[model samples]
Target: MKLIVNAIPFAGLETGITRYVRCLYQALGAELGVQVGYLGYHGLQPTMPQAADPDLWSRQTKRFWGLPQPLIAAINATQRLRLERLLRAGCRSVQPRIYHETDLIPPPRLPLPRVYTIHDLSLVNHRHLHPKERLWLFDLFFERRIRQVDHVITVSEFVRREIIRDLGLEPRRVTAIHEAPSARFFPRPAAEVGAMRRRMELPEDYILFVGTQEPRKNLPLLIRALALVKQPTALVLAGWSGWGDQAWRQLLEPLRLEQRVYTTGYVDEETLADLYSGARVTVYPSLYEGFGLPVLEAMACGSPVIAARAASLPEVAGDAAWLVDPQDPRDLAEALQGLLADPERRRDFAEAGKKRAARFSWQRCARETLRVFERVAARKQARRS
Candidate 1:
């Protein structure tokens, strides 16, 4: 069956969703009997396949700024019209049986069956974290798209439950597909890790946290926990700063841990892999997550992980790492201290994590997604018949 994968989100710089779409498409593209076409505003670009080393496709594209508010609104409206025209063109040329909306935005009402992936329902549940104007627009446009789609897919069971409870969707109408870490996240040798450290100028020993600096990530609490640890390990945060730097600084100030914390802002895949490899331990104490990709990535890199027990974290970690209550900074601090002091425990966790990481793969995710596509197409055919 001909399938059109929506790729609008790729127009900007890389994010978690970008990696998810790129990995799944490349994995599915390698298979036989499935013709795939990427329908994106950015046009075609190089993508990484499963056979190649994950780092091979890790380069970042040029970044672009959005137009002014009113102008951006008009431009997006025009793009939506153009996308509709493009969909019509595809329907006539390739006659696709299914249109998968990889990003949350639904495709312009189309004749073909529609499938959407709902990464998280944070916008609805944790609306306070987002800018009011953006949240308003998201609720207006994306919420409608979620309800109108033929089928929905979520990355975690946590998100699936939220969608059903908040949006009143039927459980069967949504499928939960867990995301896997890139193959490059596997354990790296000491020499390789050292080379990456030199290239990125990362400290020789540190604790790591990788993700956007949103309040939902619970960075302030992690900072507090870091201060409580008696170890001399530096805290290195890797990701672009969102919201503002004030909250991060304010939390670190009172604890006198300002000098111990470092922010790398953003780094490429090679550097990121090295950061994961060389770190003493990685901690992810987010308040909520649809899926915790970093927990698995750190596990794959042979680093002991300490993640929050709330939301989908335990489902992802699966006894491989120390699970802590994110709401309690004291508990998080105690877990961090315990893991830091015990080398045998760290090694034990690392070995178990590698084994657990082995269970997930992008190829498996793609195959499950393809089954959903087939089901969506069959339902459409039944209605037509």
Candidate 2:
């Protein structure tokens, strides 16, 4: 079957969504009977030869927006017109059995079956989000997109439930496909781990937390917990700081734990894998998640995971990691301390986590996703017939 994938997000800096889309494309591309074409502006100028290059699609899309507004708007209009022209160009080129909008944005109302992947309801659920963001979510995007699409795919059951509850849609219309950590997240050798640590200037022994420093991550509670821990262990906060950088700084300032609290803005995948392998433990005490990718990644890397018992986390972590009440700093602290104090427990968790992580793979996700596509296409075809 012919497939048209909205791969616009892949052109931008790598994000969770971009990674998801790229991996899905690669996994599905090799299958026996499928043809996939990406539909979106390349981040380059219309006049440039690169604009027509499929490999440069992402870059061209970015550059399109970088142009002056009037020029950009005119170019965008032309692009849209061209897309319609191209879509109508031929039955062969246009008769895609499946149209997948990988990003949240729905494609123009199309004749073919359409599928949308809803990563999270964060814009609707996040209390700390800006008003404009809330407005865009509630008033502008998701509700209408959900109604228009033939099927919705979410990352986790938690998100699926949230979508059904919030949007009053039938649960059957949404499929929950659990995400997988990259293959690179698996255990690295000790010597390579040491080299990574030296490269990143990471402490010999540290407790790692990946994800943004947003209020939703409940980082302050983790910071408070760290204060209470008596061990010589340091806390490494990776990922870009989210909403609470000032508060995070204030919390860590007077504790004289600057040496103990390391904030690496963002590390590359190689260093990240090393950091994960070498960490005493990886803690993810978030208040919410659609699916906790970091927990899975840590587990896959053979890092003992300490995660919150809230939202989709417990479901993601299962019996592989330490589950704690994210709201209680004391409980988190005790859990961290307990894990650190016991070598046997860490080893058990580490070994179990690796095994658990092995069960999830992009191949499985791709197969499930293909099923959803087929289901949606069949439903659409039936309606037409």
Candidate 3:
């Protein structure tokens, strides 16, 4: 019943992986009490049950110990030997039945059952969208390391299919466990939403897009679509400015959407809830996704969504969102125009979205994940018996 999750990713940036690890661990820890622990850069920390709020744990740790991505990679490379030693020490102390690898790095070769969660095959699928350094590490370790795991987990069925086809993993060996939005994202009161809007200097009614501004997010297509939309409603770009900002900016330049587009760089989850609640319609036209989190998050917050019919988005959005071709600006623009004009449709979608989002919860995700771990561990034990 004892489990140790490699939490070294928490020492790095607060990406989607970090959220997944934190949330899953919190729920698992709550369920299992002291039976679960986390293996960080230092060693083993059997302090799971103590984490009342996963976000609190992340805030305390990330601020105190977070490192830049490149530096974290360099440190991980240099500390592999040390890491193995720590792993051995942890194994001896905790005697864990399972080791969960949250990040893509291969689990240290050990007797314990291994569970590796592959968020996406973006590196393999879209090399141009990723950095050279990342691709280099991926090429060196991903294929070799992936084979060492006892079981694989993916965030979505689309990714599960990709892993099965590309890596040739057995279908039963890989499971797709969907992620859920934090409890923080829900319908905020109109008064609170108005306050947040004023604080961020956002328009009263705006279309919201939440994600890092990267090429893979398909920001250019969204920007082009925004220009094409005749509605005077503004577009709020809420997230960190990832790479490829120039290309998106170039597309935005000629459109003269400087006044129409509001860039609120990197808001917190609380702010995000307000943004989502206040939004007329939330648009996510990403080219690909392992799981389109914002689509669900917005849905949870009572925002009708229009997501791209690409990758796992349609699966995540289901019939709750207005699915449009990511490549076609006209399609996106028309969806926007239609959604903006129809209040009743928006209300219906909002209710349906809430109902759909209610189907997912971190507790559910944790329980299903635990079932996977139990099966893997029991299989290993059976082999020994």
Candidate 4:
């Protein structure tokens, strides 16, 4: 049976769900040997920003906020409605056996089988971190659309439980599938690593944190931890900026970490591999996570990782990373110091991490996800008979 997977995220940022959808779709068609049709944006026309658009929140927010905000929302909603109507017509014509929306945004309700991947309920569970208007948009457009789907796929068991709890769906209807780092993430050669270090002007010995700059990431606490570390290690922030008060930037001046903290903004995949490979310790102290992709990617590149033990991070990190309390900078500082001061432990972690990372693969994620689609398709077929 043929499947239609949304490829809308291919147009926007390379972080979070866009990366997840792009990697998952590539594997589904190429590795799983599934007959798939590409739908939504790219090669054709306009589509909503995929996964988490770094600019989505600001685009919706007006400087003053009372009248212009609502006016803009009304106009944008009208445009989106027209585009979605055309998209629904296109999907009806293709009439694929299954339609999977990898991006969290749900599609227009269809008669055919439908599957949606819900990365997390962070916005609902941790509402303070997100803007008010952003939450309203979800409730207005995509909240009910989630209930209209045939089944739901979650990235981690933690998220799967959240979906069943928050959405009040039958446990059987939701499934948790693990995500993996790409083949390009493996340890790079010395020559390649050296070239990337020089090109990016990155320090040979530094700590790394990869993710958007948002309140949920808890970057300010990380900066405090960096200041406390006895070792002279620079901290690198990779990925694009997202919504949230970046007053964290002001802390740099007072803390005297301005010279030591660096940002690569957004780097290409090959450069990402080099960045991960060169770090002395990769730190991810986010307050929450759907699935910690950076933890897996750093492990794949043989970088020793220190991640928050909360949520799905421990599940993804397993025994590979040094887990820390995301709230306490002192705890984080101690962990960083220990890892940096000890070379043998770092060596041991590097060896074990590569092996741990091998357990997850995009091909495997594709296979399991296809099984969900096949099960739904089979049920539909039996009913028609």
Query: RMSD of each candidate?
Result: 3.8, 5.3, 3.8, 3.5
lDDT of 1 by residue, 1-385 (tens): 6787777756543558877887788778876356776775543222432222223322321111123555545555667667767766766677789988876555657888889888887788877776554554565577556667899999988888888898898988999998999877878889998997777677788899998787888898898888889997889998766554467678777889977888887666667888898888999998888888899989999999999998889999999989999989899999889988989999999999889888899989989999999998998999999
TM-score for predicted model 1 compared with the true structure: 0.90
Residue range 276-301, candidate 3, lDDT tens digits: 99999999999989998899899999
User: Measured by TM-score, how close is model 3 to the native structure?
Assistant: 0.91
Model 4 segments beyond 4 Å from truth?
42-80
**In candidate 1, where is summed lDDT lowest over 10 consecutive residues?**
57-66
TM agreement with the true structure for every prediction: 0.90, 0.85, 0.91, 0.90
Candidate 2, lDDT over the whole model:
0.76
lDDT of 4 by residue, 213-313 (tens): 88999998899999899888999998766656376787899999899989987676788899899889899999999998999999999999999979999
Full candidate order by lDDT, most accurate first: 3, 4, 1, 2
Candidate 2: deviation at residue 276, Å? 0.7
Which residue pairs collide in model 4, if any?
Answer: none
- Give every collision pair in model 1: 239-265
- Model 3, poorest ten-residue lDDT window? 48-57
The collision pairs in model 2 are: 11-58, 42-60, 42-61, 43-59, 43-60, 43-61, 43-62, 43-63, 44-60
